[model samples]
Target: MRLFFKKRSTFKLFLKLTDWNNLLNSLTQNVIGIINSTKDSFTGDGVFENKERLGFLLKTAEEKEIKILDVGGVSTKPGFKEVRYEQELKRFNFFISNYFGKFKLSVDTMNYEIARHALENNFEIVNDVSGFNDLKMIQLIVEKAPKIILVHRHPNSSDIQEKMNYKDVVKEVRDHLEEKIENLISHGVDKSRISIDPGLGFGKSMEDSQKLFDNLEYFSFGFPLVVGYSKKKFAQNLEMTHEELYDHCIKSGVSLVRLHIAS
Candidate 1:
């Protein structure tokens, strides 16, 4: 299918698209389908590097009616090789330039420059897993005013995988999110435009991650919650099946889940 940009106001479309109450309350869970552009994704589901697979997965996503597609060029997994800004931009452009479909787009990147390019190119959401710690990234959000997914990682660590001890994982994560949200609002970003992710596997042990997931309700401070639970190491250790976990997430008022197509 060809890229189709609807002849409508983007801001209005965004508001219409993100009907928060409907999404949170709906029995049908909404998902932000994860599509990696690099070859080293933790789940081995990268697509943009392989044209054939990319096409197939895009088709699958369309057929599956995935409304929000989170496209990432860099792998946040531990030991993932660092991709230069140019290479990551090229990978993102390859996908953005080629596909325009019914689904809204979310660019998953920690780099401010990459997020700027995606926003310039009409990507709707900025899924910054670095928790918007970068001042430049925050300034970009202030200027562009795009929907964002602010993730939580340990403050002491530089990357997503370096686990740090938490006196209380749930409370710590909630406080981190609360602070981030306040920062965004102080910078003039509408709180309604922001969503949150607890960053499972980003910096916590499996026990900590599980504890946060179990107490997801604690983080429900009016803003919608976005979760990326697919293939998380913590989920493997849960007593319940993935299906049960997912159902629980939806029931817990999770607004969006970053999931693979198979899920």
Candidate 2:
């Protein structure tokens, strides 16, 4: 399947060469998947030196018919070190070229250059944790691709506990997501192809994260909602095993989950 983005005077056009309607029709239930790469990725899923393990995980996901497989080289966890563009590109190229088409691919990156590379390699989606902090990333997606996932996060913030200063957590997250949606629409990203994620542990206290989840329905923004709470500190607090946490996230209306374990 191939997707094309064409820009005209006013609105942009998204052209698909495959039967997208059929594909969507086939996906009747919400999906259960995993985000399989990280560098101190909060949940300890980052395996920079273990490329073979990453490939094995992708193989297992394919065998299980997982709906989405998010591959990210950079860790967005608090106080994470920034990765150079060249290094990210190399890692992305290696992963995609070796494991492309194993499953639906969503590249987790905030850098426009990395996003562009993922799209050029036929990745189906771009997961930006910075909530569109980089304008070039937005422009590339608007001009070259239609499907993208915008996750809310403050670029200047660090730890989740320290970033909790919202008057109303739910309202604040909803408003920020609304702003992102408007920005994408203005820049020509098809509203139909956009999704919203309220960065679960990105910069929210455990209590704040709970409030956001409790009020998730209020911030749907007329788009599909994705929640990434797999193996997070909050989930771990439940004292459940990895498998239990995965199942819990699936049952909690999470469209896609970011998991460290393959199960």
Candidate 3:
């Protein structure tokens, strides 16, 4: 709630248009492939069966040359049943023990227990749609020292809340991220280990998400920027393929792009 940057402004960093692997600590932007382990995702990729799905995750990452793989144990979309901590960790542990050291890993979960477990198994990033709202999550992240992605959400009508309200969408999102970043730093988390996601299609409407995508540079927050524009309903609304939207984002200075499948 406390705005960190009084005089807000966008941060600029140049990356080779064709060579985006160097954008995030020299990691390629080929893709941050999404491998959902849940049973019911709105996008239709969730797999409850572990052995087969883990194989899919590994094979997809390997074949596509995707450097970062984001494994979501629980369904994060609205109207889905909640996944118990036990179930969530089970999927994550199996994946972490097998493929952790082989590649960079991010777990899309908001539960502190699951996050702590993933970090123990050498997971490097936490992509929390709740914007890391839990104090316990913040504590674990501070102690474990993995990258944290705080996604913007406006508390909403569904089980997933995106309660965002603002006249200037970009400025509001930027202010919110900066405020959260300052709070994390004050609580002993390293500034360099923080990143922000605009939470496309989460709390924001299609228009708000588009504004955030267009103004990606404004919310860099001096940390890595992750653009998640793949398979979203908003892309469908605009009558543009996810790949088409993805290219537009990269041109606007997206360093890391999270996708349902690697392009």
Q: Point to the candidate with the largest TM-score.
A: 1
| Candidate 1 vs candidate 3, lDDT winner | 1
The parts of candidate 1 lying over 4 Å away from their true place are 1-29
Give the local distance difference test score of model 1: 0.77
lDDT of 1 at 62: 75
Question: Compared to the true structure, candidate 3 yields what TM-score?
Answer: 0.83
Looking at model 1, the pairs that clash are 3-100, 160-202
> Quick one: best lDDT, which candidate?
1
Candidate 2 weakest lDDT stretch, 10 residues: 1-10
Residue-level lDDT tens digits of model 3 in 52-157:
6667657766665567778888876755677788888877766655553267778889899988877877778888877877899999988888877778754342
Off by over 4 Å in 3: 1-23, 97-101, 154-160
TM-score of 1: 0.87
Provide the lowest-lDDT 10-residue window in model 1.
4-13
Minimal lDDT window, size 10, model 3:
1-10
Q: Which sequence of candidate numbers ranks them by TM-score, best first?
A: 1, 3, 2
- Candidate 3 clashing pairs? 21-27, 21-28, 154-162, 154-163, 154-164, 155-162, 155-163, 156-161, 156-162
Residue 130 lDDT (model 3): 78
RMSD in angstroms, all models? 6.1, 8.2, 7.7
